[model samples]
Target: MPLLEISGLTQRFGGLQALTDFSCRLEEGELVGLIGPNGAGKTTVFNIVSGFYKPSAGQVVFAGRETNGLKPHRITALGMARTFQNIRLWHDMTVLDNVRLARSAWLGYGLWSAVLRTPGYFRAEKAIEKRARDVLEMMALTHYADEFPKNLPYGLQRRVELARALAGNPRLLLLDEPAAGLNSADADDLIRLIRWLHDEFKLTIWMIEHQMKVVMSLCQRLTVIDFGRVIASGLPQEVRNSPEVIKAYLGDDTL
Candidate 1:
């Protein structure tokens, strides 16, 4: 079975019809890209899959279970995690704390154990801290472990968000416009890091991106959406040559 399957996913915001009959699937260990011009409902698809918004119609099946109505936290616990287009790090928290909090869903100790300062609580806390540190080190952000996210550069802040998502130990990772605010050099670095992470963690990744260069360089397959409907999907080269895709982005004159 595919690691993630989104079938006939549709969303309507008071007749806006943000997405219609959208469908896609990701196999285990595949890196797929969703690309489109702005307002094509790419982020809408991410929101639906990650449980931030329930689709007006359709099914989101992750790991063979229907997830349309599940809460975001429940979905995260089910082994899915996502990074937002905008860095959503906790501004007040230390970088290490930000990543540590993502592991809260996996904490084994109960509230009573925390209040009573049970041995289990201490053990769980120690484990969470160690895991957070490990993730930060993997992302090469250990130097900023004690700094606030707002104090870091934009690119580093983006890495912090990625680390937090990884802290969840997710089987499927959804990245929304990860290259949005990166410079050319930083974008190249991010592409390499993403590829490394996919191989190292054996994760299935689905990313939404507007930067064609980033998508072309990283994604094995491309799915293009326009006005909430898929206009083309195939290998990167095939999708790039698709007439509909050309017209959508470059207009009929180019076609």
Candidate 2:
């Protein structure tokens, strides 16, 4: 079965329909791109899939289970995780601490364990720390593990955000414009890191990106949306060559 299945997904806010009849399927270990113009509802689809927004109509199935009504935390527990378009790191917290926070969500602990300092809590805490460190090392941010988010460069901040997301141990990762504000070198490094993580973690990645270079180089399959509806879906080359996609993103540089 496909790792993710989105069918007839629609989101309505008051009278505005953000998405309509959005449908797609993602297989295991595949890296797919969701591309569109600024207001094309690509982020809306991510929001729905990640449980930030509920769909007004349609089914979101992941790994054979229905995910339409699941809460965000519950969805994370089900092996799905996402990173936001904007940097959402705790600016005051150290890079390691930020990632450790994500790991804590799945720890086997309760109020009693915390109040009494039980062995279970300590054990879980240690495990979380180890996992967080591992992710930081993988992202080449081990040197800045104790540095605050605001102390790092913009590109490093993005890496820290990615580390936090990976700390959740997700089977499927949804990345929203991960390379948004980076120089060419930083963008290339981000692409390499994503490719490395995809293989190392055995992950299925779905991303919404406006940077055509990132989408073209990183994703094998592509889905294009316009006016909250799908305009095209195919391989990167096919989508790039599609007339409809060309029309939707016209006047911009991606040609």
Candidate 3:
């Protein structure tokens, strides 16, 4: 079975329908791209899948179970995690603490155990710290682990967000506009890091990226949506050449 199955997803805000009959499937370990013009409801799909919004109609079958009414934290505990278009790290927290907090969500230690300073609580705390440190090292952010996120560069901050998401050990990762503020060099580096993470962690990734160069170089398949409906989906080259896709978003200049 596909890792994620989204069928006939529709969402409406009063009279404005943000998404209508949107559907797609992602297999295990596939790196797929979702692209569209502004207001095409690409992020809406992410919101629905990540439990930020409940769809008006349709089903989100993840790992063979329906996730329609589950909360975001519940979904994260179910092996799905996501990053936002903008960095959402806590400004006052250290980088290590930010990631360690994510892992703590699944630590399963009760409040009494934490407050009483039980051995299990201490062990869990130690494990969370080690996991956070390992993830930071993997992202090459060990040097900045003790620094505040506000002190880091934009690209490095983005990596921190990814590290926090990975701290939960998710099987599926949803990235929204990860390259939005990056330059060519930084975007290229992100692409390589994403590929490495995908292979190293055995993750299934679905991302919404406006940078054509990043999408073209990284995604094995492409899905294009416009006006909240799918217009094209296939191999990167095939989707790139579709006349409907060109007219809808890519335009004549895009490769």
Candidate 4:
């Protein structure tokens, strides 16, 4: 079975049909890319799959289970994690706290245990801390552990969000424009980092990225969308040369 499968998804907000009969699937340990022009409903698909929105029609089957209206937290518990295009860090907390909190779903302690500071609570807390620190070390963000995410540069803040998602130990990772708002140098670094993480962790990654260089360097397959419908789906090189795909991104100077 596919690790994640979204079938015949249709979403409508009042009268605006953001997505129409959209469908896609991700196999285990594959790196897939979803590319399109602005307002092509790419982010809407991610939001639905990640449980932020309940689609008007269709099913989201992850790991062979149906997850139509499940809450986002429940989806996270099912080994799915995602990052946003914009940084969504906690400005009040330290970087370590931001990453450590992602592991809260596995604490396995009740309110009474937390209030009384029981052994189980302590152990879980310690484990979460160690996991956070280890992930930070692995991602080379150890030096900023004590600092606030709001105080870091944009690139490092993006790394913090990625680290938080990884701390969840996910089987499926959804990245919404991971290379957005990055310079040429930083974009290259992001491409290499994403490639390394995919191979090292054996993760099933699906990302929505507009930067052709980033997607071409990292994705094995590409899915193109225009006006809430798929225009082309094929290998990266083929999709780039597809007439329909080129037309979809025609006037965009960013490509």
- The best candidate by lDDT is 1
- Please give the lDDT score at residue 5 for candidate 3: 99
lDDT tens readout by residue for model 3, 35-112: 999999999999999999999999999988899999888888889999999889987999999999897558868899
lDDT tens readout by residue for model 1, 113-208: 999999999999999999999999999999999999999999999999999999999999999999998989999999999999988889989999
Error of 3 at 154 (Å): 0.6
* Clash statistics: count for each candidate: 0, 0, 0, 0
lDDT of 2 by residue, 1-255 (tens): 999999999899999989999999999999999999998999999998988898999999998899888888888888888888999999998999999999756987988998999999899888989999988888888999989999888998888898899999899999999999988998998899899889887899999887778889999999999989999999999988988988887855664
Top-scoring candidate (TM-score): 1
Candidate 1, residue 51: CA error in Å? 0.5
Q: How much lDDT does each candidate structure score? A: 0.94, 0.91, 0.93, 0.93
TM-score of each: 0.98, 0.96, 0.96, 0.97
Worst lDDT run of 10 residues, candidate 4, spans: 246-255
Residue 80, model 3, lDDT: 95
Compute the lDDT for candidate 2. Answer: 0.91
* C-alpha root-mean-square deviation, each candidate: 1.2, 2.3, 2.3, 2.4
lDDT of 2 at 218: 93
User: Which residue pairs in candidate 3 collide?
Assistant: none
- In model 3, the Cα lDDT at residue 86 comes to 81
